[model samples]
Target: MPTYISAVFNKDTRTVEFTADNGDKLIRSGGSLAWLLNNPGNLRPGGKYAKMIGQADTKSGKFAIFPTAEDGRAEKRALLRRKYNDMTLYNAMHTYAPESENDTAAYLAYVRKRSGATDQTVIKDMTDEQFNGMIAAMEQYEGFNAKPETRKERIVHATQVTLSDGARPMPATPVIVRSSNTGEKKVTTNEHGALPTFITRQPGEVIELFLEESGKIGSRIGQFALQQASASLVFARNMMTVGGNSQPHTPTQPSKEKRTPLRYVVQPGDTLASIASRFKTSVDDLVSNNHIRNRNRIYPGHVVWIYGKAPADAANDGAPATPTRSRQASYSVRSGDTLSRIADRHHTSVDALMAANPSISNANRINPGQKITLPVGVEAVPPSAAGSSRRAGNSGNPQTSDRPSLVKPPPETPAAAVRPPASVQARDTRSREGEGHPIAIIPFSQKRAPWVEHAYAQARKWAGKKEAEISRTINFHSELGYGKQFTTLAGSSNAWCASFVNWCLRTAGYAISSPHPYRARSFAADTTRFSQIDEPVFGAVALVGTSHVGFVYAMDRGRPVLLGGNQSDQINFVRFNPATLRYYVPKSYLPFAQKELKETKLDELAATDLNAALGIVVAKKAGDNTR
Candidate 1:
């Protein structure tokens, strides 16, 4: 059987080549959407037919991706057989290619004309020849048969002519080479539009070459070819002199001033859209600057680099960047005030206060009149209020207050100079080079650890939720700033298992910093944050061969039950082989594992049994954990 093995787009020819298993091929370009997606029936994503065949790219969630033309045709045939089983040809075409989205009358007419069937002809009663003709006719009417306006024929050159001025060989121009022999045949160029290495050292064998439109331009073989037959053809590398350097020379390096990116610490309730608005930049810029794969995965205490200055920065005033939020929102440093004293007085931790303010370089020394943003839920009186209350009540104005003020605090890190830690700077360098893994804002080494139960709880909350509903699907993707990419439920190709995991972790109060953990491999790939374990544990991340991942909610009969998204097209608990599972927990959370298990009464979970096994079944759909 002729089967489509693979397809690849050719940039030089601007075409897609679908190669069959039998070595046959078809080059297509400038065709219909069906042709572009390799979905002959224009089957939308999320359809059971596409899903059952496992032919659709669920991540893109757009169209079914059929590897070969035969596969696409087979899918269409299956659809007709199953969906239009008992319906008449007219009714089937009407429902299949509805008038709302297609030329239904023309489609029906064309299919009937080609198949020699009438409106009363039942799909099940159609002959094999008629059924095949109907499918082919429908595909043609759908515009799969459309071709480009013109195709450029490839040219072959016998000799690679060199132009004078010699640093390197110039690109071969469109010139035709004709054999001077009696055959008078026009030579052809290879796919790259370059001549094959064809010229031999045999004497008196001359080939004439000229521009495509010009008449016989004579060229002597002796002028360019060396006498050695093995040499093939050797043109003087130094002959091209159109502004080319004749002597060995090095180009002067141009000096460029380096622009340092503005470092901003992420705050609670911060989204990429909101941050972009504050910094007067687009979300795209922030994603590019940080190499962020999932814009929604950023959390409080995470550091992001901004290439543009805030709108308030241009005025060069010391005023707060967000004027709407400046009213009594921040605290003014007083004489002899230390970060520790302020943190204690405000009933917040010193680390929390410092994390909320990345501009503070030293915790020990704080200058008087310097503004400090309090942590969320922590309130303080403005300097004006303090002065008024001091005048009204007593002469002594103590910094400590029995009742905390009611005013909301401003942004955690206001527009000020930021000095990132040396570790962050080094990580940033590696991030730009694409060599670094995503950094955890709160490293697992810290006392603040991710609770697996919380992640499990978050996953359970979305149980039975499917991407078939556009609004709910959009909500899932919106967590990572991908809501806009999906106009419809089927329009998204994002495998959201990773997003689900990241979302669950973020909502559970864990922060992932840098390089967006959008891929399933990300969970296992970030060794600094999550540590591998020997056996399964409740709430542990179950990475299944880098393509699928989920939380280990429980163990049944020694098999780990995974709670994850995109499982059978919804959030559900499915059992997998313990042998195929690699479990990882937050590095710092490992110490509390026994406590967590005891507290949750999960100590009796099944132990790992190497003998138990299941065939490796990695689902490749809807951006689940796919490699």
Candidate 2:
């Protein structure tokens, strides 16, 4: 068994700290965490992080960082304790000792004298309780003039609030700030969607903020602590449209004219199809009810209207609906029972049977007396109805009959009895039916490379932003040491197609060796670092006729779908003719394995399987052929 570890994201430091069961700690930057959270599908089986978190099995206790309300409370408590200790020590030093080289010694002497201690005392040597008593005594000795009760001055903390949907700022949104110690008050956000700095006198002060707009409420509670100056809060609401205008509306009693439809808050990684599947509804119905113009663009915290009554397992408060398990029947394996034979008897496909039992690895192997689940309405074939060929003999050998045998046949008898001429044998071997038959195997190499995923993830973070926003982000990237090449490319008024790709690759841990990293043609001509390939794979850098460059993320009707920057001035997918594809640069880590399988027949393998192997999910649009 592997030890489970929990990771907590420290927004202040922009680092993620992992805690093990034994109290050991490991810290890493927030980039990887952001990638994982944004691209949960990339957490595939056998990946390095997936194994550590035990994602392969739901029963495994290990999980990636998904902070719950309880975890937040515990973190708050820890922050408060540290802040209190630091404040107490700071007051003791500043009040008793002057600013001098012997300040520590003088403070220790004053503490001992004030406490009336005969033994020598040091600040570090005293217990927390004793230190507090000494500080109180010293204050009293000075005629109690410092007002020890209010010795700690309140510090004003600033925070930004935004809508969970699209992470867009909620400027001018009315908010209510309440503190048990400081009292409740109303406030509003500035142009940046930031609340005015509120003062808190000490640590452990719980500050609750509620977003009040158009009579709707979105609340979050947290604590003020030392060394923690700013925070970003996401405000979520059950938004709906009323009188042809979008508004944040809470659940209310249905009027005589209408009944309130159940509300479903969209979560990250949610899609209209997925939400419809969960609620036993249709995507068309969801779009119709929500008046959604773009089905692919729903964001987290956006409240979608479900026109039907909530499922029995669905909570009224927009909790996810508990999935209903399908009915299944168990069957014991018999001698010589193959997965294909079992599926044939139960009227299920081998793939369906395998899906029903995830633990079953080899479809050809099954042990007698081992139990497996079968789809409901399937029954074992009666012995009388099961042909004699299907039965295994007492020796556990399958009987020979009309049914085909599972074992491979012995090699054909040596042709020595009638040996053919070398020329004839050579001609036969050269036939298309012989060794020339193409194998359509999808090798493990077809999966998207980690670097590609990293680059794609970075590109997605900038998707949907305007040119100015993208330019600002590019400038920030340069300041973070992305080099002058990026800064020079971004400073120009020219199209930034190549600069975007360069930025993504640099962020994904790839170094650009092109003499002119700003030009798409430069990447195409860089033969030393990049080798041109005929076929495109996910995450491959693609050049389009020396004018544009982007990452190939999908295929549609054999055309590469480019997910790159400057596509309509934003990161988006643009399908291009295969003929327009000029050069392809494969990631160094993921070299091609025999190029793509050359199967003449498209049905040899499903396109969905190919897409799954490549980790590509092409978004469908009106008149799109990929769908």
Q: What TM-score, computed on C-alpha atoms, does each candidate reach?
A: 0.33, 0.26
Model 2: CA > 4 A from native: 1-447, 476-492, 593-627
TM-score of 1: 0.33
Give the candidate number with the greatest lDDT: 1
- Residue-level lDDT tens digits of model 1 in 24-141: 3344655555665477777764444432211222232345557655667888898889889799998999899889877889889989999998999999999999999999888877
User: Residue 464: error of model 2 in Å?
Assistant: 0.9
Q: What is the lDDT, from 0 to 100, of the residue 50 in candidate 1?
A: 35
Find the 10 residues in a row with the least total lDDT in model 1. Answer: 397-406
lDDT over C-alpha atoms for residue 583 of model 2: 50
In order, candidate lDDTs are: 0.47, 0.42
> For model 2, how does the per-residue alpha-carbon lDDT over 138-248 read when each residue is reduced to its tens digit?
433323233234322122322323321111223344555656555555555432233443322354556566555454444342233211332323332222111222122
Clashing pairs in 2: none
Each candidate's clash count: 24, 0
